[model samples]
Target: MRRAAALLLVLTSALALAACDRQAGPASPGDRGRLPLAEYDMPEDDVRVVGTARWTLAKECMVRLGFDRLRDLDIDPLPGWPRRPAGTGVVSLVVYASDDFRYGVQDPEQAARYGYQAARVDYERHYREKKWTLPEYLALTGEFVGDDPKSVHGHLVPKRGCLGEADRAIHGTVPQDRKDPVLDLGAESLEQGKRDRAWKKADRAWSACMRRAGHRYATPTDAASDPDRDREELEENLTDPEYDLNQPSAAEKKTATADARCKRRTGYVRTVHAVDVRIQNKLIASNRAKLEDQRRWNRDAARRARDILADRS
Candidate 1:
């Protein structure tokens, strides 16, 4: 359930940021060989431009308000993960599968030996620690209405500090009335794919593969959310006082390997990718106008951002 909620949040956030309004070019027959989902995904270049500009402006604002120390303190955009061709598809399935196979565990022996726990621990220990001072935080996140005051340049901060000011300067506070229909369209497409004859046939083949592997899962999702696995986890947590729930156990590693192998053998990922491509192309065609509007907004934003950065430089 937690995984499901996280997936929903990621999808919704992506769709909400769908601001490009340009029409996609007609897909060539050869284009089908490439990832179809990439066609409908957000423009990463535009996002980077606007984000860099916002950071630049916020830093400038902070300096103007007498927090010059933060001027040299590097403020940067959070590094994004390397995106898969299918965008959020694999992430959406994380609820049903183990982390080992979530991104495709190529070497099962290596995965079992090292497990999936090392990187997370390193990330928390290094990147997740507090790296910013209070003034820097205030500059980036704006002021609160009911907080005890902190002095920056011996002045009580105004409501909605540097971050808010920078935001207002670039993209005004009045929210756009438009909504991105991609999420609704994507959901509709998934349903349609489920009913698609080809998808259904592929699903059956995958299910048969799982059954052969001694797992009675009707779908990858079923394997991901296996009741018996959940029950075993619960029992283990209850009985073992020293068990670390965050770390994948031996049983989990075994299950993940089988799940990955079954998926690979049945070509479930390819099937799902094909279905998503067909649906997304149709959605793009129907929603050209909205997408174009978003594109225009983004282009304008990018232009303004460039201008702001240029002036500073």
Candidate 2:
């Protein structure tokens, strides 16, 4: 009976351990110093929790950066009078492969291979711009990845991006910068028209870059294209609040403009949360049904990444 009890105890312990493993998170390769974002070490769940996390965190980052939670816009000719909430965002997830991972082991692994790198860089740059504004966090960027820093070329920040390895060789995020343009109080623009024109040009350039980088164009070319279907997806993203339709740079460029704003819009940060993520339309939840389909792609992405990395490693 004592022996039987010991065996049962072992079984119970093993089951408990397994359950804990299920709840636990994956390892976070980055550091915890002065960055605007938090690096979580959660296990990759069956659900695309990472994508959800990315969306939540990116929104949180934008809120911390300045703007109120995102509002929507009406670029339509005959705009619908009755509008809806801008909805939850679409988060992109990409996982790299073995060949590319090995290449990353070599010097010069190209991030364009996985288009997600651009937005990640934008996030980091955006974080820095905002973090620096507060004197208390002046050193945020300095220790971003912590001590024993990898060479910039290393898979360190994932900014240069994942070379495509491990269980899921991808990094993820929601690109709030794509929502719209805001004033770069630190940057200098010419005429008001020139500035607006620059913003328009910059938006086009970034859109082109998104395509080149392999992102599906999220915006609909035509509102009548799919009507409800199109409206649902577009509304659930980084938005352009009227408050964000900014004016001019308040001062001269004291620091290099963030790379995230590399494509440019009338940019900079006063408090920062005010700059990056702006939404035009004020959202109201109409259906009360949380959109679940949008996350399908991200889940497929996460599973595929795990499979590819498993095969490679």
Candidate 3:
């Protein structure tokens, strides 16, 4: 569930909030390889819903339990907060709780199979696109993408792309490595023994992140071409204590943290499929062994190429 949540959030969030989620994608490679559903029949009474291309509820069972389609949801972040430390993505809540699989299966066991299978495909694509490192993923499991598919940020997955778009704009390749002054402030607070101060800083950072999505946190770029003049001007401009990140918005402080975070620009592909399943089963969902095999292959290949490049120099 935690794995799914991380992968699902990107796709789910776009579907949930984007003014236009682009009606799924044209036939994907995996779509052609899908197995027929007629192969299995295990349930007479089960709750299931299919056809995710269009939004519909499987069952509106209870208060707030029944789902309804919405044109879109509001996603703007709170204003007057410190900007996210450069290149921070817009932050928002994402929820996905479907009583059915997009591929149409409801046989509990089969449902789990079809459901998690689809998740694996998406997951693989996500990892491939993001070029995710396993360790970084493990770190974020506790907070951002927990064990619940229903509660996540949801925009982690892309709607359509040949390969996952690697955003060099934000710098950090791994989820946790990305620029996020919100979390950074939290750490600082813990260090300072000032929980209240930390929370306040975090809130400001989040607000900034949510608003200034897609910005980069760039570092010094060799004196900005003009060299001496640029450096002198920049020094003069920054001479004031106004750049201090500890201070929140005061009509003067315009989210410096966010600016700091999003100062760099680069791009890479994000992977979708991370797990490799050997056989499509009923009860057991993911095959850790297969997944690890694929991961090891990718890691080794990348390492060798990088080593070659280093050796050349």
**Candidate that scores best on lDDT:** 1
Residue-wise C-alpha lDDT for candidate 3, range 175-289, written one tens digit per residue: 2233333223323323333223433343344334525553222221111122454355456657676653222222211223222232211100001011111112311233335
lDDT of 3 at 26: 17
Model 3 misses residue 167 by how many Å?
16
Could you tell me the C-alpha RMSD of candidate 3 in Å? Answer: 24.0
Model 1 worst lDDT window (10 residues): 1-10
List runs of model 3 lying over 4 Å from the truth: 1-24, 28-90, 93-110, 113-313
C-alpha TM-scores of all predictions? 0.58, 0.18, 0.16
Ranking by lDDT: 1, 3, 2
For model 1, residues 1-313, the per-residue Cα lDDT tens digits are: 0010111112332232111111111122221254333344335465556556666776777777787776874535321111122332322111112222322333445446434433334223222223455455454444322342454667655445555555556655411233534434656766787888877877788779767877776666565456788688879688778876557777666655676676578776677668867876887788877666655655676677678878888
Report, for every candidate in turn, its global Cα lDDT versus the true structure.
Answer: 0.51, 0.23, 0.25
Scanning candidate 3 in windows of ten residues, the lowest lDDT window is 267-276
lDDT of 2 by residue, 123-147 (tens): 2222221211221111111112123
Instruction: TM-score winner between 1 and 2, please give it.
Output: 1
Task: Please identify model 2 stretches exceeding 4 Å from their true place.
Answer: 1-268, 275-292
Error of 1 at 108 (Å): 6.6
Best by TM-score: 1
